[model samples]
Target chain A: MTLSLDLSHRFQGFTLEAAFTAPPGVTALFGRSGSGKTTLVNAVAGLLRPDRLRLSVAGEVLADTTAGIWQPAHRRRIGYVFQDARLFPHLTVRQNLLYGRWFAPKSPEAAQDFDRIVALLGIGGLLQRRPGALSGGERQRVALGRAILSQPRILLMDEPLAALDEARKAEILPYLEQLRDELGLPILYVSHSMAEVARLATTVVLLEAGRVTAAGPVAVMLAQPEHAQSLGLREAGAVLQGQIAAQEEDGLTRISTEAGPLWLPRVAGEPGRPLRLRILAQDVMLALQAPQGLSALNHFESVVEAVHLGDGPGAMVRLRAGDAAVLARITARSAKAMGLRPGLRLHAVLKAVSVAQENIGRGA
Target chain B: MTLSLRVSAVATVVSLPLGIAVALALARGRFPGRQLLNGLVHLPLILPPVVTGYLLLLTFGRKGWVGQWLDQWFGLVFAFRWTGAALAAAIMAFPLMVRAIRLAIEAVDPKLEQAAATLGAGRFMVFLTVTLPLILPGILAGTILAFAKAMGEFGATITFVSNIPGQTQTLPSAIYAYMQVPGGDAQAARLVLVAIVIAMAALLLSEWISRAVARRIAGT
Candidate 1:
């Protein structure tokens, strides 16, 4: 189902104007802190009333201020997974998951089943436990299950992983990917992390100071220089569009990208599925002469588009491959050694195993 | 003594829900003249007992506007009846009950109520299930306060409802009656001891109940 949100809300000393149509997939509202990403998601969930707003989910009019139509939060059918999880502390995990089901409109046959949600989120073993007894990751998983059992047409996740540590984030990301793939429900995910946006988002909506700076599919937007500035040089990288070329022996998998065929550690998925590999700027090594790499397995010939020297001890070199651009953050010593300059011809060397499977964005 | 206890219990029970409703309104709801409503609820607590009783009598006596209407419409009487005594006692205790409940409601986390609303509960459902249960300790405290106040109510009951024997004469009224008559001083002193015991017992009972509820809800 499609979710269309066009809203303008003004708060004290801030005005939020955002408009986007998210298709059935995970659409990440990417931005920095205080960019009104949470405000936009709250508006979609009917938690915040916008002055002049028009929002509809799958053709159902949820809010249209000009038309004098506004459905309250309860009737909106948009489940929100807050950053804090917000699970009912008074109830057990099982009761919290089933809390929304009791109020769900009865049907002759429920399409979005309940038991399926329990197994999907892997909360069967934790049904009897309270939210306080569960770990951070477990609480998030249960929160997601509760939201799904509510049978929401669209799910709004606001930094669901922000409160979690890196390890906990890794633990919960797979379940989120499973939900995106299995449930077929549209999700409007809010986050400040571009890595998360690159990994999970089919569409990226970049917000800055309460406005839509850029919004489009992950691949094209990430390639733009404007989008690159949103992500800093060190974190900025190319999202290599590729398919599972082949699985090599010794547990490494080869994938083809616009730059060239690349190999990475074996990912836990079938062959022929599309994958997204994030090549960080720090990971790329530029060579004036195509040096025979001692250990690195992937190399791509590119033209250096621009070079920005840092006041510290490094330089950021932007490289353009076949259709996408890659960044290389190299020390000034190495840049001078290689005689690197803007519009210079160079070959970028990247280690095959250095690009871990965790960086790969699975198919939406 | 038993009549006084029964009168206090009846008055407490009758005014408990009204006090709770008014408390929640004062704590949560926004309306025009809210401050005025708050002051009106607190008026009896600040005013002298005789003054409150005089106001009640002026409005609820047999020839009064409300009393005449009740006599004509439903043949109900609040003038010099046991019901009238209970009303006088409830009015005297209403402020204490309302103050306790209002503080409790304010202490409850509103985010919990918002969470309930997100789970498909309407406003009334959220209040009934989430807000009310969490404030039960406060309600119990309010009940005990109102009960104690009603048991000690003397000026209001005698002034508005009259100290009629076997009808409106509660324990306090009986004690007052005995103190007025010759050779009834011993009876009046005995009733005072009964009042102290009842008040202390009510206080201890409320404390026990409040602790039990707090432990259960707070999981301690």
Candidate 2:
């Protein structure tokens, strides 16, 4: 399924003109604050009647202003998870989750399916409790459950985890990953957190001041140095799809990527389960030959896909390791000495990649 | 005392739906004559009780146009009757009820309504399930306030429906009648104490009910 939108909305002093198509996966609407991400989401949800709009989800026309077709918010059949959780305070957790189901048309999409969703979100214990009694993470889980039970054509999640603290965010992120993978539903996730975009997004739509600056797969969007300014320089990195090969006896976990198998500190996942490999550009190193290892494991043969030199002293080098793309941010002086160009074959080294913090996450 | 209670209870019950509707319109509706409607709803609150009663008499008295039409068609009369006292009390209490309900409606977050819409609830359904439930405390408070005001209504009831013993003479008018007589001090004092007790009980009852309601809504 694909969600497509063409909206032109004018605010008091700002104007937003955006048109994009989101594929059937987690497509992150990535931008900073006041970049019209929320406005666009609201427009899609029919909460805000944009100055002009033409939106369709999986070939179903939702709104086309020129054609005088307008579906009110209640009839849109799109679920939205707001930043504040917006759970009905007067209703219990179970009632809040079923609020939408009451009005949904009779089908699997709108089925009560109560016990399954409750167990999936781990909100079974909270069924009898009210929203006020739940923690931030628990409330978000219930909110997600509520949106899903509504049986929407597409889910619009506007910074669903933005209100939670970092610890709470970590607590709820795995549930979101489970939702993305298990639900098999398209989610248009709005966020400014590049790390979240890198972890959860299969596709990235970079927004800047109400316009789409770039939209592509996660690998290309992050590895593209031209987007470094919007996607923070330090946060820009390569996102790889990999599977767990084995758990090494030395407390290391081997992940099989398209490029080759890379070893990291013990990551908790069963063998053959998918894991996303997030390598910070600064973490990758380059070599002219297979150098003897100090602590590094294997080197993979790769070609220089693109070399970008900025005003700063650092230069970004995109490397093609088999079918996968890896980004290495090396010094401009080193690039000059190595004569790195678009097509030079070289060995891309991992240099014992650190698993500090959120460098690895569950696959979507 | 029974007459006063009957009048006040009838007045409050009769005015509730209108009070909520007017309050909603005043708080959220964007239309012509909104300011005029708001001012008209509040007229009884600001005007002297006697003035409001005189206006009601001109409109709803048996000899008045609407009152005459009702008498001829439905054989109903309000002038110098217990029903007229209820009418007076309801008018006097309208402003308080509208104000309380309006403030409650304003306190609700519009975001919750938006969430309900996305959940596939139409506008009326959203109001029934979300808006109405959330404003229960406010409604209770408003109703109690109106009831209390109606119970205490004196000047309007006396003006609109003359102080007729056993018919329109409410507790307040009855007390006034007692105080006008020489050596009626003891009876007047007892009735004043009774009035105080009733008012205090109503206030405490409303406080307790509203507290329980607020707690339930908050889920704490």
Candidate 3:
């Protein structure tokens, strides 16, 4: 399934003109606030009418202004998970989850059994509770499950995690990854956090001042020097898809990455499960020589692919570790001292504990 | 006092739905003459109570346009009768009820109603289930205020339909009748106290109900 949006909307001082085709995966609309991310998603959700909108999801035309075909939000079959998780206060969790089902078209062949959704969202324990009783993370999870139960062709999430604290965000992201891999649902996720985009998105659409700055696979787009500047050079990194190999006795979990095996502080998942881990550029260090003894647990031999210089003080070095690429944010002085350039071999060391636990997820 | 209470009850029951409609229209609907409609709704409030009664009498007298049609078709009468007094009180209190309701409806988050719409509720369904329930506290408050106003309505009722004992003699009209008669001060004073107590009690009751409902609906 694919979603396409060719829309132009003008709101106050902001003018948004963006056109992109998002493939069946998690496409992160990454940008700063007031950069038209929410506006673009709202247009797709039919919450806002653009000046010109020609949008389709899975070949279904939701809006075509030229043809005068505009489907109201309910008929669009596009589920939207709002940032606030606007659950009905009067309804129980069970009732809230089924709120959209009454509007969904009859599907004799594709019935979404309610029990399955309850279990999938892990709301079985709190089915009778009201939304006010649930924590922020739990409310968001229920919101997502409610959207999914309606059986949407595509889901539009407008910063679903923005309302949660760091712990709440960590609590919900695994389920999100599970939804992405398990359901095959095309998701349009809007967020300002580059870390979230790197961890969850297969495709990233970068927006700046309401225009498309870049759009492509997450790996290639994020590796670009221009993209790094927008995402902050310190936050730039590569996302590695790995699987849980085993849990070591020393409180470290080992994962098999494309580069080889990487051991990180213990993750709470079973062996052999897929995981997506983000190695932040700042957490990685480059060594001119293969160090004899280093306390850091992760070290991979990589050849310098490109060195990108920012305005002052720092440079971003891209390296190819086996078939995978990783980034390191090193100072200009260090880059010169280490004689770092394209085609130079170096060892990249990363502290096991410095990698945020939230960035570690189970990758297929 | 009892007659006035009955008149207030009947008028409130009759005009509650109309008040809600007018309020919603003012809060959400846009039309060519919306400002004119708004002004017209408040005319009874701004006019002298006697002038409003005179207008009601002109429009709804037995020989008047609407009164004539009603009498011919349905044997309905609002001319110099208890019903005419109720109508006068309703008109006089209509603006107060509508203002409260309109403010409440405006305070409702349109996004919540939109959320309900996207949940597969039709427009009417959304209003009935979501919008109406959320604004019910306001409706209750408005009804109580209008009822209190109607109970104390004397000028419009007496002008439209003379203060006939047990017929159109509401609380205020009864008090007025007592004041005009010889040796009737005590009776009028008793009725005045009853009216004040009822108004205070109704206000308190509405406040309690609104707070309880706001808690349940908004969960704040």
Candidate 4:
């Protein structure tokens, strides 16, 4: 299902005007703090009535200010998983998980299997315990289970992992990926962490100062030179979707992407399982020709698509290799000496160790 | 003592629901005249006990406006009766009831109520399933305070419903009556000791109940 929103709202000293269409899968609203990501999600969830809005999910109109059509939050059937989980403290985990089911519309299609949801969230062990007795990650898991049991048409997750420690975030991310692959539900996820965006988002909507700066498939948006400043140069990179081709000897794996085959440190997934690789711009090196004397395990022949000169001595070069895009950040002096411009052919080299294990993740 | 217990218990049980409703309005409602309603509910607490009793007598006595209609329509009477004493006690204790309950409701996070809404609960269901259980400690505290105040009510109960033996004479009224007659000092002293013990028990009971409720609700 596709979700579209054109909304405008004014808060104290800030105005949010955003419009974007999120296709099926996870559409991430990515931005720095105060970029109105939460406001946009709140508008979609009917938590905030914007000054002007026209929102629709899968062609069903949720809000239209000009037409005077507004649905209250309870009737919207859109589940929200907040950053803090918001579980009922007065209830045991099982009761909290089933709280929404009591009010769900009575219909076969709206009914979710109780045992299956509990098993899926791995919260069966926590059923008898209250929220105060659960760990932060456990609380979030129960919160997810509660929202899923509500049978929402769409799910809005506002930085659900933002409050967790690194280990806790790691613990929950796999469950999220599993949900994305199996639930068949569209998700609008909000986050400022690019690493998270690169790992989970099928589509990325970049917001800056309450405006949608760019919106497109994650792979395309990540490689655009124009988005370098908004994405924060240190975290700016390209996301390549590929499937594991084979497990090679010497603790290495080969993956095939649109660009070409890539060899990296061994990953745990079986052959044919899709993997998303996050290649940071700082990890990429550019050469006029393929170097035979280097230890880098990955190389791509590409033509420069665009050159973005930074205010400092650095520069970002956008490149197109086959059908996939790659980004390489180098010194401005090198660009001037190499006469880098659109259509100039070059080689992109990447060391195997530069791609950290954390940067590689399973894809839906 | 049995008459006093019955009067106070009846007054508290009858006013409990109304007290909760009024407390919710005071804690959450934002419409016009809220301040006026708050002041009116609290007037009996600040006013002289005799004045409050006189007002109750004027409104609910046999010859008064509501009292005349009630007697003519339903043949009910409050003037110089035990029911009238219960009414006076309830009115006298209403402020303490509302204050404790309102503070409890205010302490509850409205965000939890909003979360309940997102989970498909309407306003009434949200209150029943979320707000009520969370504010139980406050309600218990308020009810105990009101019950204690009603048990000790003397001036207002005597004014609205004259202290008739076996009918309108509550514990405090009986103590006052005994103190008035020669050689009745011993009986008055015994009743005073009983009153002190009841008051202390109510206080300790409230403290224990509130702590247990707090611990259960807090899940700690």
Residue A323 error for model 1, in Å? 5.9
The superposed Cα distance between candidate 1 and the true structure at residue B216, in angstroms, equals 3.6
Could you tell me which 10 consecutive residues in candidate 1 chain A have the lowest summed lDDT?
A351-360
For residue A294, give model 1's deviation from the true position in Å.
3.6
TM-score (0 to 1) for chain B of model 3: 0.96
Q: Tell me the tens digit of each residue's lDDT in model 2 across B28-91.
A: 8999999999999999989999998898899899779999999999998999999999999999
Interface RMSD values, listed in order for every candidate? 2.4, 0.9, 2.7, 1.3
Q: Which ten residues in a row have the lowest lDDT in candidate 4 chain B?
A: B211-220
* Chain B TM, every candidate: 0.96, 0.97, 0.96, 0.98
lDDT of 1 at B21: 92
In model 4, what lDDT does residue A163 have?
A: 98
Candidate 2's docking class is: high
User: Would you estimate the TM-scores of all the predictions?
Assistant: 0.88, 0.95, 0.92, 0.95
- Which lDDT tens digits does candidate 3 get at residues B9-117? 9998899999999999999999888899899999988889999888888879987899999999999899888889889988888999999999999988888776666
What is the lDDT, from 0 to 100, of the residue B49 in candidate 3?
Answer: 91
Give the CA lDDT, 0 to 100, for residue B83 in model 4.
86
C-alpha RMSD for every candidate: 3.4, 2.5, 2.9, 2.4
Give the Cα error of residue A62 in candidate 1, in Å. 1.6
lDDT of 3 by residue, A269-336 (tens): 78877766778888889998886777887898999999988889999988989878888888999998
DockQ rank order: 2, 4, 1, 3
